[model samples]
Target: MYIPAAFRSDDPDLAWQLVEDIRFGCLISGGLGLMASHLPFMVERGDAVRLVGHVARANPQWKELEASPVLVNFLGPNTHISPSWYTTSPRAPTWNYVAVQVRGRVRVTEDRETLRRMVLDLSALMEPDGSPWEAAKLDIAYIDKLLPGIVGFAIEVDHVDVQLRLSQQNNADDQRKVRAALGAGSLRERQVAETMTRYLGRLPE
Candidate 1:
């Protein structure tokens, strides 16, 4: 991702937070050609950052992983910033958003234990109030029947590129105006505005 200094963020914690905030991501890989899959991934951070997710057995994207590096894109709230909201005259419209790109080599797995854990962990992450669902709740026969239809993989994250374009290039006064304009828009726009507000507050003026 091409990021200007004002919009670039190298904070590892923030990058991981973005992944947690946006559970869904696009996994891009190329071998014979470019292939992408939208998936909900769980992040595991220890000695290294790893992303675990699965694709349908019918999806050909999994077969290409060994031949290509993977790029996972986690996108956060984004909204259009109208130039009309800027205090500066002759300003052009721009987008205010946050996104993180994780690049790494992928290792595919079909082991029963690994697959089972992957499913359970994914379920736990998506549920509220500390995840009530358990993999054991399902019949073993049913799980066995379903297991072969999917393939799981883990990407050992080697690089994380973060971009946070939240009106940082503008003055504080103009930033407030932009936030107000966005807040008055749709729910998603308001979300984007809130992220901008929080991020801007952390910066030194």
Candidate 2:
């Protein structure tokens, strides 16, 4: 990710929060060819950051990942900015948003025990409110039958890049205008805009 100095985010906690908030991420690997997989990820703390996830065994992306550097993209809320919404003269439209990218080496794990543990940990993270579903509640035989169909892996993060482009380059007036336009738009767009407002400290009118 090419982040300008004005839009760069250096807060590790905020970056991790974004990653947790957006569970789905794209795993990109560069090798004989560029391969990518859209998968849900779990973040674990260790000597280095640990990312765990799985993909269908049929997916070819997993085969090319051995000893290769992989990039996982965690995209947060974002909104399209219309040039017409700016207070200044017309300019090209752009996106206002926040995203984090984790670059690391990919390691595939086939151990059934490890896979089962990963699945249970992922469940807990996704349902922290103590949902009805628990790992032990499932039938062991049924769970065992399904384990072979998927491939699990962990990425030991080498570096992380976080970018928050909330119109930091724009003046107060222009940012306010953009925020207003976004907040008045669709629900999803408005939600993202509100987040930007809070993070950038743009007072609501």
Q: Pick by lDDT: which candidate is best? A: 1
**Measured by TM-score, how close is model 1 to the native structure?**
0.93
Give the alpha-carbon lDDT of every model: 0.88, 0.83
lDDT (10s digit) by residue, model 2, range 14-93: 77777888889999997759988888999887667888999888988888887578999988888788899887886899
Question: What RMSD does each model have against the real structure?
Answer: 1.8, 3.2
Q: Residue-wise lDDT of candidate 1 within 106-202, one digit each (tens)?
A: 9999998788778877876687775566655877777778889999999999999988899989887998898888889999999998898777765
Candidate 1 deviant stretches above 4 angstroms: 130-136, 203-205
Clashing pairs in 1: none
After the best TM-score superposition of candidate 2, give how far the Cα of residue 198 lies from its true spot, in angstroms.
4.2
Q: Residue 119, candidate 1: how far off, in angstroms?
A: 0.6
Instruction: Give the TM-scores of the predictions, in the order they appear.
Output: 0.93, 0.88
